[model samples]
Target: MAMYAYKDAARTVKILARDAQKQDKSNRYYCPNHKCDAHMFIRNIEGVSASYFGAIHSHGHINNCPHGASNRFNPNDYDEDTFEFDNALLALTMPGMSQTKKELPGEHGSGNAKASPPRTIRQIYSMCKAHDCSDTYNGVKIGKMLLDNRSVYMYPKGVFGWRIIEAKCKRPHFYNSIKKEISLIASTAGEEYTFILKFESEKLFKEIKNVIFLNRECFTVVAGQWSSSGTFNVFCTTFLSKKQLAIIN
Candidate 1:
């Protein structure tokens, strides 16, 4: 069973099982892992549990596919108190730049030099999903600044709609040439929250704009620091790359 699946044969777009229920059944679904060719179908047993994707009997996932091992996100595997921010697994700077190491909890010395390389946007998105978008853990460092949970906004549950808006630019022209903003609204039960993404790249902005324009309902995960002011409205002013944002519908 898997919580996510590719919505198209090209495997460029991913869709959550719960969200897939709203889509037409005629649409094809495939394994989220690009290496896996297993066909998937929605399984929504009315009273048992939430909707999810199940592999067809004749089509099985490949041995090397991560989904083949286990697609469920086990919360027990992650403890916020013990969770240490892995800079190598999370982008602090843009892609292609060398990732710096942050000192682990109760650890001395420069840092772990053998740590793995930074993860892709999809990998970071998967990690957030596995943790249910919890941000109560070791802080994430960008440059010389360390941002705690208070300054971070995880992927909110029940994201229903989003839109792009013009934002004021205050950064130096030589460093930041483009400025765009996207506001995502998520509502679940009786609660509502707006997550904002203020970026400086026309390419990233266009990518997000196209996804929202093409899909009726989509999910987005952004890795950045939240604005210091706001209750229901949370915004980020961090520079973003294509690898820092993950969009699925």
Candidate 2:
């Protein structure tokens, strides 16, 4: 399926809400919650890959009443932080980013930054585009928007050879607990990939074998290993904002 990036959720929510309203014209203008005026309904859930709503009830977000009044909310209204990732992060972790990061060593220091390192051909291209907010690789740039800001803020100066890794906790509260997300998002361009595997403790490899055997993807290990060293071909020349650039800015 063609995935809709998280930033696009606002647009999606409007469409869904309009559809839901069409299902019952009478219910078009009210929140479904019997107590809350049906003000809030599903605007856009995006890749809510998980079946159950995690904390909607606790947060007063669920209400299915057909006639009940509900508040009008657009999924796009909520901050991007509420979702796991934006588009840029998703695109970066694709299978190919690992080799790309490793190869970008020459382009690292070519840009304006004195801190530039040896970057690859791809890295050079992305760094220049991302730093300037140019739409060089549109999808790739959008993907970066999905990444958590903490990881991308330093921009061309901060990340190198990075990839997002899975969390040790099967039931992570949010993507934040999922470590290396910044690195993974940063890896989207010519930068290298780094995957992380979480273990119960810093035990021996044998003790962590259970975790090892459970790897669902190989990049998880490959990216993790590469992340250990700061030596990546692509280095961020400047920090860029994926969200604003993709949508508002």
lDDT of 2 at 100: 45
- Model 1 C-alpha lDDT versus the unseen true structure: 0.45
User: Model 1 misses residue 65 by how many Å?
Assistant: 16
Each prediction's total of clashing residue pairs, residues at least 3 apart in sequence or on different chains, is 0, 50
TM-score of predicted structure 1: 0.40
lDDT of 1 by residue, 140-188 (tens): 3221122112112322421222211112222222122244766555443
Which stretches of candidate 1 lie above 4 Å from their native place?
A: 1-118, 131-179, 229-231
lDDT of 2 by residue, 86-184 (tens): 233433333343444334322322222122221221222222222212121223343232222223433454333333222121222211222312222
Against the hidden reference, what TM-scores do the models get? 0.40, 0.22
How does each model score on lDDT?
Answer: 0.45, 0.26
**Candidate 1 residue pairs in backbone clash:** none
